[model samples]
Target: MPKAGRRRSAVWACFTENTASGKRRVLCLFCHHDLVANPIRMVRHIVRQCPNADEHHKKICREYQALTVPARRRPVVGGQATEAAKSADALELESARVHSDASAPPTE
Candidate 1:
């Protein structure tokens, strides 16, 4: 049969018998433990929780976890307010300025 999606990651090599029902589950190669096939849980199991997992598997799991982590968002500079909050504050100030200018009598 043709492939269904992208090739599975090398990290999945540590697991097998991936079965789908209400939730997907896989068998850990090192511990023979059945676990949800979610990547984070798999990595955690191999790296920290699996008693039977060796250094090699733990190293691989750590690398996979590092790779899968979402990139850290850039921090807002100089204040606690985010960009959207600053924009909203600016807009409010601008509208107030415009409203005040409009209400003032015209000068010669």
Candidate 2:
């Protein structure tokens, strides 16, 4: 499925494509390296994980990280994703959307 509105789109902005397994995926803006689409993708790429992340990724990462960083880490498998992380991210995105929707008038 497509993401929600602006809040989710910030995380989606890092994406390049989706896998056959129904997971939307992202490539490092600095290196075009592929990974699952999530906020931690920003944190991992901006921090220690991605060797190619640079200034561009840093700004995007920071923006998305503020919206979606989970409080804990999920086990990673060869840099691949798991369902738990996806669900947590979904929850975060939903939470952000609900909060925004309640606090502001509908844009259109």
Best by TM-score: 1
Q: What lDDT tens digits, residue by residue, belong to model 1 across residues 5-108?
A: 88776668889865655568899997789998877888888888889988887898898889897756567778665655466678799799999999999999
Candidate 1 runs further than 4 Å off? 1-4, 18-23, 71-108
Q: List lDDT for all candidates, in order.
A: 0.81, 0.66
Clash totals, every prediction: 0, 0
lDDT per residue for candidate 2 within 6-36, as digits (tens), equals: 7555545544664654777666665667777
TM-score of 1: 0.56
Q: What lDDT does candidate 1 reach at residue 82?
A: 62
- Candidate 2 RMSD to the real structure: 18.2
Work out the TM-score per prediction: 0.56, 0.40
Error of 2 at 38 (Å): 1.9
Error of 2 at 49 (Å): 2.2
